[model samples]
Target chain A: MKHTLSVLVENKPGVLARVAGLFRRRGFNIHSLAVAPTENPNLSRMTIVVDLEGKPLEQVEKQLHKLVNVLKIQDFLPHEAVERELALIKVHSTKETRAEIIQICDIFRAKIVDVSQDSLAIEVTGTEDKIDAIVSLLKPYRIIDLARTGKVAVSRGRK
Target chain B: MKLTGAEAVVKSLELLGVTDIFGIPGGATLPLTDALSRTEKIKYYLMRHEQCAAHAADAYARATGKVGVCTATSGPGATNLVTGIANAYMDSIPIVAITGQVATSVIGTDAFQEADITGITLPIVKHSYLITDANEIPYLFAEAFHIASTGRPGPVVIDLPRDVQNQVINFKFPEKVNLPGYKPTIRGHTRQIKLALEELMKSEKPVMFIGGGVVLSNAHQEVKKLAENFRIPVAWTLMGKGAFPDNHELNMGMIGMHGTRTTNTAIMNCDLLFAVGVRFDDRATGNLKRFAPHAKIVHIDIDPAEIGKNVKVDVPIVGDAAIVLRELNTMIENNNLKKTNHLAWVEQVFEWKKKWPLKTPDSTDLTPQFLISKISKAANDKDLIITTGVGQHQMWSAQFIELNGPRRFITSGGLGTMGFGLPAAIGAQVGKPNALVIDIDGDGSFQMVLQDLGTIARYNLPVKVVIINNRYLGMVRQWQELFFGKRYYAVDLEKGSPDFVKLSEAYGIKASVVSSVSELDEKIDEMINHRGPYVLDARVKEEENVFPMVPAGASLDEIIGGD
Candidate 1:
């Protein structure tokens, strides 16, 4: 099972390396990860999606909490959290495929961020599933390049 | 008053009650060394290598229960400290390692003697700091000591850039550390403690599996109280050697790989395994699936990550070992808990112990066991601190030496570093000047860091180095003999080995060599009674291997020897 953990950490150099090093050392499989500054200037929040097949999710959480920079960790169930992923898909586009690509981007509510004579860069943001669906739709037109900001998550709550 | 970062570091160390530091001066750390020399509050012992500095600091911490301090320069010097830092991390010794980093501008530019030490030590340290500004020195130093000594206790690294060290700033030591993320849980949850106690009361074949945490927390008294009050047998890990008295009837020797037959048997037979401060490591667990199969485990550890790390637990309590044990002891006393007798279980364990005693062969050639036994007897009356290099000799020392109290046996239990003993003995000797510090080492392991003999001579530290001179790397050779068809590839230490007696003499230390069993007692006495550092190379039987062996990946029932 995949576990999405929202970790709050002190904004310090090597904190991310420490966390990443731990996961590597312990052999925990990381599926996706996104880190950014939080509301507090001195703190940063990291959204890590880990595949926990061999070890328990609780153990990973406990281990993350062991790092001195890690201030807080919350494991989010799929239903209890709102997760988002952003991706930029650059497709091989010519006169024949440009209109079709724009139509597909329109259907997914994505915007054409950049357009050249032979290619189009489309930016899309949604849950991982929606992004995957759009990517599959555009795959018929050869994907020249693709980039994804793995997943960022926030718990849906007032608790 | 304004002061340079180097001065701030020295002042901060003094403020933190650090009386001694172990390190050698180098280019990157020259400024810090100058400042250290200028300060009268701290004494610096120049080590031959950065690795020895770290090991000495680790042993100092283990011996004194204080945060041991070590320093080193950038790049290779910092890299050399990795093994010792990892050793301390594994054993949970409180130590602060200060490394001089290349200037901030040169850290990533591959400048002379540049290394990202903080990055290198990220996984092993409890916390680390790379100071870019001089002002951070006071705060970082305070935080380094706080993190190293607090909660579970592990090594912490502070990487001081040369430019940052030269920057001048007003020095005012932080009054308190404000790390909101690093609060250690001291007291066990009441409900969990109650549940654990209930499990103990219900168990008929209960055993307490203790480890390094008990020693780290100074909870030996609490562990003894809990075990004796409940009539529970205590089986200790190698790191937990001195946590309980070896002579006590209830103490069932060291457990796990290279552990006693009786301890393993008791662990297998026990109904309730109350494990405190043990990680249930692979060496200790053998085949995890068959380990303590019949027991319902209640594990108490300060680090929550360790609670269910290797083995699942029925009841998990996260708290400091000493505090939790103390709380449990108090609750038992206040509630007047009935002590259940396990006479049958105790008798069964005693029978196993009597039947499968760790035996020494009837031979005139000094075996490692016989040599260690002689040393143990000679040092029995003195307050002794025993350290060992990893291998067959380490196991023999652990088996033969009877540690009566905590803080007596210090070894690289976690990392099992080969060259840990000599420098660690120096550290222990330096920490406890009056105590007899002995390094029981193998011929191969001793040769790894033999240069530290200079440190011992210069300091005039009365650390006795006893090398069990088996011609081969005995432990690996034993494995080859058993499992690898006796193809002893590259395990021999007989070729190109230095004459240790001459090496010690050159270093201005007393030295001796004993090849016969008859000379063992007299030689050990002479070494122990020596006024300064001494080295005794006792040539032991080359082919003898450590027994009561559970071959790798084998269950406890598959133990090979007990005859």
Candidate 2:
């Protein structure tokens, strides 16, 4: 089972390492993680999606709570939260293939951000499934470079 | 109020009621130690090595019920304390380790005498702090102490860089810590406590299981009362040895791995297991699959993470051991209910206890069991403390030594660190100056930190060291014989093993050698009667192995009776 854990940590040096080290030490597999500063400058929010491999999410949360730098943790069920992922892809483009690539980007609602003599860089942001679909569509092209920002999540309901 | 970070650190420790600390100073520690030297409130014990220093602080915490303090310089000194810090972490001993760090400017640059002690100890400690500002010294130190000694006790490391120590500020020590994420649950839920009580009341073959938490919380009295009221047999882990008095009828000796056959039988036969302050460590539970197959587990612990991690618990009560037990005891008393009689069940356990007893083979000459039993019997004082180095001697100490109170039996139960005995004895003696502390050690285990003999001698701790000199790492040799067809790889220590008696004498401590079985009692008495630190190296049979063994991954009932 996959678990998306929204963790609020003290904004300090080595907090990221502490969180990463804990997951590593406990043998919990991380699928994706995105970290950014919250509205409160004192706190940073980390969105970590982990593959528990039939292990209880409660165990992972309880262990995470033991870290002093970790201020709060909320495990969001898929339906309870809104999640997004961003990907930037650089694909080989030619005079003949550039028009076809632009059409595929339009169908996915992705924008062509940069154009070089031999490649076109497309920027896309959507649900993980949408990102996965676009990456698979672009795999046929000779991909030059790819970068992904792992999933960032927030609860669907109130503050 | 104006002071440097080093002075603030010393002032914070003084305010916290710390009278003694253990460590060795280096270049990075110069500023800190200089500030420490100005204070008469704390006396520092200079140890021979950083590892031994940490072990001493650990034992001091165990003996005194105070957060033990130790310090070391950067790099190798901090790295050396890792073994002892991990030992304390595993065993859940409350200790505060203050390490010197490189200047804040060169922290990540791999500067001279630089090491990230806080990061290195994150997984091992309950919490840690790397101080960046001198102004936060008092607050961080207070927080460190609070986190270390509260709900589930463990070690905490504070890494203070050299620049921070030298930075001057107006120090204002806080009375209470304000850590939003560091609150521990102290009271058990009323519903869960009631459920646990109802379950225990209905259980015909119930058993009370305990671990180091009970000892750490000093919940022995409550445990005894509850066990007697419910007519339940009490089985304990090695770390829980002193939680219940050995003389009680309900008391079952150490259970699991090296546990007595009697206790293991009772645990396996029980219908409901009331586990208090236990983590259900694999060594204590043996095979979790078959452990207490007929039992419904009621686990009450301070840390929620420990619940259902090892075994699925039926009624999980998260709270401090003493608080939970005290509430339960009151509930039983106030209800005016007639408790079910478990006389038949108790009798059944005793019958098993009698059927298979611990029998040590002494066909040839001196046996380790005989020597330990003699010392245990001779240690009649209420204040006498027993510490052990890991291996055959540790198991023998757990079995033969009779403990009637908490904090009297101290050993590296969780991490099983060797060379823990001698330094622990020193710490225990230092903490309890009027108490008699004895370290029962093996030759191989003793050789690891033998240099610390100078520390004990210099302090005149009046601690006694008894080496169960079998001339080999007996526990490993036994495992090789049983599990590996007697390969005996690296288990032999007969060649070039130090003469411990002469070595102790060389360090200005009293020393003796006892080669005959007849002189075992006399030598023990002499060591006890001696006014200063003493070492008694007693030669025993080389092939002696601890009995009533349950092989790894085997159930409790599958114990091999070597009798």
Best by DockQ: 1
The root-mean-square deviation over C-alpha atoms between each candidate and the true structure, in angstroms, is 1.4, 1.2
Q: Give me candidate 1's interface root-mean-square deviation.
A: 0.9
DockQ of each: 0.81, 0.78
Chain A TM-score values for every predicted structure, listed in order = 0.97, 0.97
Off by over 4 Å in 2: B362-364
lDDT of residue B420 for candidate 2: 95
- Give the TM-scores of the predictions, in the order they appear: 0.98, 0.98
- Model 1 misplaced stretches (Cα beyond 4 Å): none
Among all windows of 10 consecutive residues in model 2 chain B, the one with the lowest summed lDDT is B355-364
Writing each residue's lDDT as its tens digit, candidate 2 over B175-248 gives: 78888877889999989999999998888899999999999988889999898877788999988988899877
lDDT by residue (A1-159, candidate 1, tens digit) is 888999999998888898898898888999999999999989999999998886778777887888888999988999989999999999999999899999999999999999999999999999999999999999999999999999999989873
